[model samples]
Structures are given as structure tokens and as C-alpha cells.
Target chain A: LAKTTQPISMDSYEGQEVNITCSHNNIATNDYITWYQQFPSQGPRFIIQGYKTKVTNEVASLFIPADRKSSTLSLPRVSLSDTAVYYCLVQGSARQLTFGSGTQLTVLP
Target chain B: EPEVTQTPSHQVTQMGQEVILRCVPISNHLYFYWYRQILGQKVEFLVSFYNNEISEKSEIFDDQFSVERPDGSNFTLKIRSTKLEDSAMYFCASSERADTDTQYFGPGTRLTVL
Candidate 1:
């Protein structure tokens, strides 16, 4: 399994864009990057996933450069409801998954 | 919008007692996993079961912990001897496959050991 690093917390205001980046220096070729969001007391919800390049969905966008060492999760025009802990993970074929501390986004109004 | 379901949203048990946490995964999912999170901590993986056997597990899952798929519809985690440190929210998750598939989580069972 590949290890991942992310910031402990981030602060953003409503209507502003927020970007949280995760580093996985030992990422393997078969690893796929996936992002999940968790609100207080709720299960982590799937946000977006990407192998490389840029992938955009109705909720958020994931950007991975050619190196794939790191990836960025972009949330445009964030709202108060977007305040939550975002987890970046490398889903591997074997082993139980691992989750990091995650970047807690505080979207202050 | 099918989701994983777990029983006893919250459980309170005395130390050294036996406790069972149950889960019913999505109907189509082939892989099942158990994870736990202490309040204000990162989620930790415990075990993963597929095809009626454990495909993978973490160090956290010791002899004290066991998993079973008693019947076709239910999966369960059994703790033979609960310790004070076992107080944490246990989450049940399932994926369509054991490899390269996203796992969906349940609301979690908050276990409080005294």
C-alpha cells in the first residue's frame, strides 16, 4: 500500500475556491487516487476519483499531473455546507485500506 | 442508493465481556471490511472478508477479534474480550470487489467499553 500525506486542516470562506493537495511519493502504477468527504458523525462519502490528468464531476474536480506523485482536489465557489474533513487515499489491490488524518475544511461564512 | 447497514447504533459493554457488531452489506457487493475510529482520530482498518474467507486484515485485528458470515445475508465482528481501549466507533463497509473498487461505509456502531 502507498502512504499519503495531507494537511491537518484548512480554512476557507464561503464563495471562495479551496484546494487540498495530497502527496503519495511512493504511488505505484496501478494505484488509483480517490477522495472522500466526511461530515460530523457521518460515513465518508465518495467525492471524486482520477487516475491522472484532470477529472471533473458535478461535485468537485481532481487534478493529477503526469508525475502522479500528488493530486489536488478543487472545490469551486464553496458553500457553508462544504465544511468537512476531506480524505485522500490510494486504493490498492490487496490489504485493508488506510485513511490519513485528512484536511478539515472550515468554510466560514 | 443502496447502503451498508449496521446494528446497535451504539453499544455499551463491561470490560472482558463479549460483544458482537453486525453488518449487512449491499446486496451486490462481494467484499466486506471493518474499520474503527476513535473520536477525533483517523479511521483505522481492521479486516476484510471475501468469498467466506478473510482476504486481508490489519494488525489491529488480533486473536481477540474475529469475523464471520454466519448466513448469506449477514456479516459480523465478534470481540471475545473487550478492553477499555476498545471504545471506538466501528464502521462496516463493502465494495463490489476486493481489488481496485471503492468501499462504501455505514453509519458505524459506537462501542463504549467501561
Candidate 2:
């Protein structure tokens, strides 16, 4: 399993963009980087995923460099409700998942 | 969109008692997994089930833990004896295939050990 490290918390003002980065120095060849967002008292929901380069979706953007040692999750135009714990997962199959403490992104109003 | 479903949103059990957690994964998904998150801690993988057997298990999933697909629709995690340390939010996840990066999660079951 690929171990991941991320910030404990981040603050973002409403309408501002937020970026959370994760480091996975031992990422394996078959591993893929994925992010999930979790609000208090709720299960995590998938945000975005990428193997390399960059991938964007309606919710967030994933940027994985060629080295695959680190990845960033970008949230655009943050809102008050976007305050949640953001997890970065490095996985090959679903079985090999390793979710870190994640970045607690607090969107301020 | 279709979603994975877990039964008994919350459960409280005494220490040393057996508890069974049930889940219904998405219809087309081929891989199913169980994860648990202690309050204020990171989510930890427990085990993965595929082809009617376990593909991998974590050290956290010790001898007291077992998983079964009792029926076509229901997947279950059975903990033979609960401990206070076992209290956590257990989540069920499913992926369409082994290589698929997307793993849909079901609302977790909150297990309280006392």
C-alpha cells in the first residue's frame, strides 16, 4: 500500500479557490491517486481521481505530476458548505486503499 | 444515481458481544470493501471481498473479524467479539472493477461499544 501525507487543515474564504496537496513518496506503478470529501456525520464522497497529468470534474480538479509523488485537489469558488475533511487515497485496487488524516478545509464566509 | 446501502444506521453493543454489519453494494460492482473510521481519525481499510472470498485484509481485521456475502444482494462483516476500541463508523464501498479508480461509498453504520 502507498502511504499518503496531507495537511491537517486549511482555511479558505468563500468565493476563493482552495487547493489541498497530498504526498505519496512510495506510490506504486499500479497506484492511482484519488480524493474524497467528507462532511461531519457523513460518509466520504468521491471528489476526483487521476493517474497523471491533470483531470477536472464538476466538483474539483486533480493534478498529479509525472513523478507521482504528490497530488493536489483544487476546489474552485469555495462556499460555506464546502467545509469538510478532504482525503487523498493512493490505491491500486479498492482493497489497497490508504486514507490519511486528510486536509480539513474550512470555507469561511 | 444508484448508491450502496448499509443497514442499521447506528448500533450500540456491549463489549465481547458479537455484531454483524450488513451492506448492499451497487448492482454492477464486482469488488466490495469495508472500512472504519474512529472519531477524529483517518478511515482505515478492514477487508475486501471478491469472487466469494477475501482478496486482502488488514491487521486491524484480526481473527475476530469475518466477512461474508450471505446472499446475492447482502454483504456482511461479522465481528465475533466487540471491544471499546472497535467503536467507529464503518463504511461499505464498492468499485465497478478491480482497475476502476472510483469507489462508491455507502452511508456508514455508527458502531458504539460500551
Candidate 3:
């Protein structure tokens, strides 16, 4: 599995855009970048996923650079309810997901 | 949005006692997984089940831990002997497919072992 590194914490005010970047220096060719969000006392919720370039959905947008060494999760117009831990996972052929210390995003009012 | 559901939102058990945590995955999903998170810690994968059998498991899934799809709808995790370290939030998730499919997770079962 490819190890991922992301910010430990980030603060954003309501209505501001939030971009959380994750670096996977040793990412494999077959790996895909996926993101999940988790509030306290709840299971992690899938946000978005991408293999390369950019992918956008109703929830968020994923921006993968040409090198694929890193990816960014962009959330537009953040709200107080968006406060949670954001996890950036590099998914490989392995069935199990290896989670790292996620970035805690604090959306202030 | 069909989501996974887990029973017994909270469970309190004594040390050495057996506990069974149950889950009902999305109706059409094929892959199932179990993950746990200690308070204030990162989520850790325990095991993944597909086609009524286990596909992979982490070191944390020791002999004391077992998973079963007893029936078509219910997936269960059994802890033969609970320890204090077993106290955590157990989450059950399922994906429609293996590769690139998004996994939907349940609210989780908080197991407190004393």
C-alpha cells in the first residue's frame, strides 16, 4: 500500500473554499486516490475518488496532478456542518484499506 | 441511498465474554468489510468478506475475532474473548464491487469491554 501524508489540521471559515492536499510519493500505477469524511462518533463517509486529472461530484472535487504523486480534495463554500476529519487514501489492489492519521478540518462559523 | 445498518448501537461486556456485532449491508453490495477505531485514533481495517468467505484480514484480526455471513442479509463479527483493548467503535461497510467502487459505511457499534 502507498503511504499518504496530509496536514494534521486545517481551519476554514464558513463560505470559504477548502482544499486539502495529500502526498503519496511512492504511489503505484494502479493506485487510485480516494477521500472520506468522518464526524465524531460516526463511520467514515465516502466523498470522492479519482485516478488522474480532475473529478467532480455533488459533494467535492478531486484534483490529481500529472505526476499522480499527489492529489487535492476541494470543498466549495464550506459550512459549519463540514467540520470533520478528512482522510486521503491511496487505494491499491489490496482489498483492505490502510488508513493514516487524517487531517482534521475545522469549519468555523 | 441504500446504506449499511448495524445493530446494538452500544454494547457493554465483561472481559473474557463473547460478543457478536451484527450488520446488514446494502442489498445489492457484494464486498463487506469490518473496521474499528479506538477513541481519538485512526480507523483500522480488521477484515474484508466476499462471497461468504474472508478475502483478507489485518494483524488486528486475531484468532479471537471471526466474521460470518450467517444468512443472506446479515453479516456478523464475533469476538470469542473480549479484552479491554477491544473497546472501540466497530464499523461495517460494503461496496458494490471490488475495484474502484465506493464503500458505504454504517453508523458503527460502540463496544465497551471491561
Ranked by lDDT, top first? 3, 1, 2
The number of clashing residue pairs in model 1 is 0
* All candidates: DockQ: 0.77, 0.64, 0.81
Tens digits of lDDT, candidate 1, B7-32: 98999999999999999999999999
lDDT per residue (tens digit) for residues B30-113 in model 3: 999999999999899999999989999999999999999999999999999999999999999999898667889999999999
DockQ preference between candidates 1 and 2, better one: 1
True contacts kept of 3: 0.74
What does the lDDT read for residue B38 in candidate 1? 90
Q: Would you list the C-alpha lDDT of every candidate in the order shown?
A: 0.93, 0.90, 0.95
Q: Which stretches of candidate 2 lie over 4 Å from their true place?
A: none
* Candidate 3 chain B, poorest ten consecutive residues by summed lDDT: B95-104
TM-score, predicted candidate 3 vs. hidden true structure: 0.98
- The residue ranges of model 1 lying beyond 4 angstroms of the native Cα positions read none
Q: Candidate 2, residues A1-109: lDDT per residue as tens digits? A: 7788999999989999898999999988888888999998778899988899999999889999899999999999999999999999887844557787888898888
Instruction: List clashing residue pairs in candidate 2.
Output: none
